[model samples]
Target chain A: MSMEGSIGQDGGSENWGPQVTRKSLMRGGLAALLVAPWTASTLGAGGGRESGGQDAEASGRTRGAGVTDDEIVLGVSAAFSGPSRGLGAELYRGATAYFNHVNANGGIEGRRITLKLYDDGYQPDPCVQNTMRLMLEDKVFLLFGYVGTPTVTRVLPILKKFQNEDIFLFFPFTGAQPQREPPYGDFAFNLRASYNQETAGLVDNLIRIGKRRIAVFYQIDAYGRSGWAGVRAALQKHGEKLAGEATYSRGEKFTGSMRKQVEILQGVSPDAVICIGAYAACAGFARDAVDLGLDVPIANLSFVGSENLLKLLTEGREDAGKYTRQLINSQVVPSYEDTSIPAVREYRELMARHDPQVPEELTREEYTPFAHSFGSLEGFLNARLLAEILRRLGPNPDRAGLEEAVFSVRDFDLGISEKVSFGPDRRQGLQSVYHTVVEEGRFVPLDDWGARFA
Target chain B: MSSASSGVRIRRLFQKTRFGIFAVFGLIVLSTSILCIYTVDTELTAEYEINIQNIAKTIADSSVGILLNRDLATLQSLVDQFLDVQGIEYIYITSESGEFLAHTFVPGIPEEILASDHGSTEPVERSLPGMGDFIEVGSPILAGVAGTAHVGMDLDVVALKIQRAIGQQVYLISVILVLGVLASIWFVNLAAKPLAELLAYAVELARDGEREDLADREILSRDDEAGHLARLFLHVARQGAGRGPAPGVGGRE
Candidate 1:
């Protein structure tokens, strides 16, 4: 068929013509001019991009750069679209809500805080991309509430390049040791407990309980290596070595890995097993141990938080209950289930006001208050500490002034945890651990063993 | 007899004039009407998709906070609140193990929908206020605790919003189409007046056999296909009236 004929047959040609008159064309052109602006205005109204009637001063309070009149911009990068997207989103929500509350209450010292968030997708490449964008494009004054171990590691070089630039990388979600170390590290602060501290705390309680033979299951990454080193160092005090050790890849299905680890553990017949991965793997290991008839008590670091583990164990409730009766866990942060603590009360209240849909009851079945979220409270504490330091800088804090202010932080106490002390040698404040055992499917504290490892 | 012939010729001329005017007006009106309808439909569809996406992002962010806080009650309450949101049809919160934690609708979601590994199982994405398919946000609880908190939102409300937007555009386009048709008809009639006058002059020349005076004149000056057709018609009339053949007559035939 001819091109025009085919086009006409297709019904599109009906929309065009050679018979159009000059007069009608003029009318159509005028109509287009009149319609174009009206359509654009309607679209702008419907799309919600036009911030009509919103106070510019209030909006400016969010986008302001570098300690402006009534606002401070903070940068954040987290995995908002990958496997860790859930955790990243949660952390962002918690931090954002808290900031919103603070902003609503006239902000910190007359300056409202705004968070510039970028999604890293839980990968190193995206982490670097997002970090650079936030630092260069957004020109945020400081970085805060970043999550993930590899992502933090990937961004270290870029962060170092910006070291002399006077930007602070504060309260990254990961507790990796290098983030707290020198040369490659300095200026970066962590709110979570170091793996060494967590593992040492786990070993300390194990030694006290008279469980000598222990096997460690780790994820073979920076997170795992740090915990393993701490475990070995803590065991060395008693002149002992791990009974057996196994490592697995992150995000691997735990069924086969758990079976293989159980077999290896069976050879050593350790009195206890320490898992240093996520709760899903821990649950898999617990289930496999039961199937293998290895009724040894299982212990895990803070990474295997209670909420996720409980949910996983609840899947095979009857069998899991029998095997996990003596399951124990070490925590670096206060338990959300512990209502008596001031931090827990504040956390509950904050959740209520900012996110009314979240449950008020802090139960083991519903909530997992691990070092990450708990550590975020540490971020809250750090933000407060930084605000104080900014105030002490007396109006305009330079890089050197902020540095001196941080070093002078001594015995600053927040209600949830113990006193935080920072000096020349000690940058990480409040090194403490809480020991708990599962009783009726919940972690119950065994002793007042806070800061025993420290 | 000549008077009767004149009456018959007038009747024929009137019929031809009416038919020609109507055909030209119809073509112009139909073309303008069709163009307006097509453009408006395309624009409205694009707007609907954008609205759905924005709403989805907002709902996803809010649900993430609930999971992180480990507030199951709050998570449940949020699911309920989502149902009331302008474009949401259904919302569900589930564990990683495929257990329903909370939902806005009472009818239980199929286990397959919760556990299906199909990538398309993710709800159809739309860009409407409070409209989107299901989005799952899983937060790991306590250090050893392994479970996912999943939130699912239905996009029916978003679909409805899209329909409403399209409907509004359709109405507006219909109004424009009607006005465009009327304007096109008026314009075609005005343009056809000169052509009708030319046809009358040709008829007068044919009757009086005054071919000598028409030798230097042509119907249309521009060298276009339409001009060519007008020239052909005038040449044919002159030749058919027993006038000498035109210079391009052999080639044209």
Candidate 2:
């Protein structure tokens, strides 16, 4: 088993082409001595990859944790279970679809993007814990694609705590103000319109339709409070106040009854009701509202996951049309059916071709993901924008230079009518809030508010 | 007298008014104090259990929908809110399939709890290794379809409270017993003082063979049985040998 015996045995049997002489052995030793350090340095520089080399540009610049010579890893914590599972699952599916496409087509400067995902089930504590693990344990290059406002609001403080590490979250899927306002705003980059914009648009459009008496139904959490504040501010502009308000605890299910909330809103006799909640609870409220014979225009925000809300409302009911009628939703992303836009067409093709599944560990519930949705489209846009920023960072990206690169993106087009922009003062990339209504089991753009409601 | 009669005499001594009152009152107060302690212990234990059961039921009801969806994070959050209630030590939720979905246990669940059967619907007394005794109550969520939520109420907390109550009761009993003994002694001395003076005067009268009025004015002026008895004794002693009535022999009558 000794090296000399094995060599002698092999040499005695084969009598190989090259004969070993003292001068030849001395020359070989000298050559190996000269090459060993170079080989070691080359392997170390290539991030211990089996591929002996990396990009010439990557070799010349500094890198950060989770950014290897050939890979860039991003961490994500989203609701992969619970009632809002579809939102998280589909969003993840959409982003990974784009990342998969990018990885297939030579990646970003030959460094493939890998998303390290954990399921927080849309709870703040778990999301915070997952964020800590992502930064401390996993050492992800950046936090990306966090879902839900409550989860993101809780994680903002954590980003502040580790500011010395240059840790930043990129394009978390929330429109809450915590990451867009002062104190924590600098730590996060947002791609979605804030809840203020969404609610203001809903309130203004509802008022324009002569529905002056508006009641609000919201989840009793940070997400709900943010949307409520938006509605309050918009109402104050017209010297009006909310007609009435009702709230439901977060993580409520579609199977749960919402008759109490329906009665509360109905008691106020509002002409329209705007709901700030997730899909399951919002769908339940809408269902119960129709059942209770209180017919009014009910609006939901983009975070409500309109596709999932519609599915939950219509899946088992024979009179599904009644539940969806007079329902309006505010979305940050454009409609996926609108192939007129270049990004929409690309998103559709890539989504179909890739068809990514939710990670196996995160899928505890039996949820059928959407083929295409506003949530998924938003996720795709987020991934695409992040890819653009990463590309702008050139081959060697550092955490320290992320803010500069993001701020450099001024009025960049993502193939949509609305141009994406970021600045030193502005943390949100998108400011447009699009309105939609359920039509023929799909959400289409709402063009004329007066015709629809009046 | 035979030993049995002698024993009866000794019992009669204790059956006397002063001795009997002290013995009876003490027995009554001591027994009453003990009964009160027993009642309080029973009531507090029952109340604590009922409080724990009500809390467990509430938690189980709220956990039903979350458990049905298999949302562990929400369930964990739900159970965490109940930890601030007094006597609540820990809470752990099990899935319908008998897997632990959420637990408030730090470090880890004890081997005793992990090894024990969690199928009991009633409260089970558990003794954890490092965590002390607990009254583990389980409420079935969705009638056991969504699994069961188990709440551990610390028995050590209840025991400590009961011990404090007993200490207070002992202090009260001691004060009552001491007060009862002092009151009994003073009452006996009050009643026996006059009788003792009358007995001594009678002994001196018999030994000196002199007819003298009772010197104790208080006893003589009592105007009741003792005064009447004193006047009659003086009258009888002065007229024993003379045929004529010695009316002045009974002085100050």
Candidate 3:
């Protein structure tokens, strides 16, 4: 009853005057203005904002893992013993060539760069296992140059889990969108151009020359899908798209599934066929195509492992010279013949000097072809970038510091004409793409597209 | 007195001094409420559009590779996966020449959505009675051969959300308005307190004439109706004091 009495009857009080004031009016107006933006921003989180790798209670004081007084152990989980091993092996050799030289120079601040390598066989599950072991069991300071899209996508949740500990993954080799964008990009650092960019270049060049009826042959998996998506998007940009398409199941060996794919593509009679698969699989398709009298220009994305594809097409064949000449491949790294480029020159010098056993299967002596490789060149560029960041860490190093140093690599040149840089939102550094064709059993830049193979 | 007469008196009293202030307060409350409700509505619509737009884009961007490689099972699976997402009406992929390649909706999409081309950069929006509102986004499978995709999304969820938000807004605004009106009543009473007290003291003076401390001169100088009444009473009181109040009170002294 007392509580009822305290509130009183609403109509009991006779309303009079003096309640309204200028100040109350202003306050009400201000409240309305302030609450709108507040509500919008609060709800914006459902969709906006980059995913994962945010440290809620971040401290920059602790040193990074796998770092020591005399040595820094880097983790590498690539396809060391699988279908993509040629690419993986070549990439590691390229990075090691640079690391070996740096170590011989007494290393950075008397610390040698050491690698702890794992073979993931280019599979997703194995990649996850290898990455976790490298991070949790092996305690490697950084994860670098792991190949393939399936592996990188599977490694996303692990990266997010270790976000609080400031685990910075450096440069997984696949250019899939997942590793380039949020949730996965939180800890992923990529140095190569995306499959999107590579395919765009291919579509542009093909369209530029009036090659309207284009076909695509791809591997049936994430890697194949990424390249297929890129080419599709690029073709769409010019109001064009794939004329025909065919896919081989993942792990399908060269020429094994080539007949079915060739039949589909040959039926279309396209002016050009853009191939998206590993070197062996693509090479098998090409060998089959040439034999079937489908003599159209064939272009493979950079992910096809260029040198290995040529090796696959040429080796133990009487018509090796004829088979390779019809092949065109996109390159993220420039031609290995151009000595004017500092990065290319550095790669060639490092490979020849340090990893001299690396072979060059050249058909012509037009330029210094000593250990020339697109994959190794990419690896070399990745290493040069890593060494630059490591030197910036001073004597004391930690994951947080490494992350900071990673972003601080602002517009710094590593010999590419396009300035390489990193920012808060930008995870990948290089955007420029190049195209090449095989001439005289060598990967020749596209400027010499129709050069006759001797 | 009858209840009707009492209500009449109350109405008349309210009309005299409280009407203007009530009108102003009522207007402010109504305007603020409308503003808040509209703001909430606009924000909700924006959020829905942004989310739908992003979904359309992500699907279009992601579908290219599978669509181009002619991965039928995977393409259909992707289509079904998108269709499984909440509020997705249908999704379809077509060749550059308008041939249906892969689609989630059977009997296929309507002619309107199917007519979309890769030439347009922005998503095309439409509404149908049974299908609700829809946004169709097209992405070209540019590199494979010649294919484009169109994804249709249902916007009935957005409309439902807006309706629900409006109901909440009305409820919240009604409560705030009621509380505010009550507080306004209290505020006006406080402002009128001095006038009420002056009137009561004047009544006491009339019952027992010539009280020295009854009149308040400061209130007479105020600019309100209470001040005007106070001034008139002081003038009459001065005249009475001058005329014969002292002679009447002499015997008592």
Highest TM-score against the true fold, candidate: 2
| CAPRI docking class of candidate 1 | incorrect
Off by over 4 Å in 2: A1-63, B1-253
Residue lDDT tens for model 3, A278-377: 8778888898888888888888887778888887788687766878766778888888889998878878887877762211211111222226688888
lDDT by residue for model 2 (A42-117), tens: 0011122122222324332325675766667687888888988888887887887788788778778887776656
Q: lDDT tens digits, residues B14-128, model 3? A: 4455667667767877887788778978998777657656765666666666555454434544555566577677766666666655565422244455455643535667775
Each candidate's B-chain TM-score, in sequence, is 0.45, 0.79, 0.66
The DockQ-based order of candidates, best leading, equals: 2, 3, 1
> What TM-score would every model get versus the actual structure?
0.51, 0.62, 0.56
Better of 1 and 2 by DockQ: 2
- Model 1, C-alpha of B103: deviation from truth (Å): 45
lDDT rank, highest first? 2, 3, 1
User: Clashes in each model (backbone N, CA, C under 3 Å)?
Assistant: 28, 0, 18
True contacts kept of 1: 0.00
Q: Which is better, 1 or 3, measured by TM-score?
A: 3
> How close to the true structure is residue B185 of candidate 3, measured as C-alpha lDDT?
71
Candidate 2 per-residue lDDT over residues B1-253, each given as its tens digit:
1122122112233337766777787798878788878987898889888988898899989987756554343455567668869889998777677766666664345768778676566988998987899998888888888788889999989888887887788778878888987888676766655555455444544554253333333444555655566545545654563434333334645
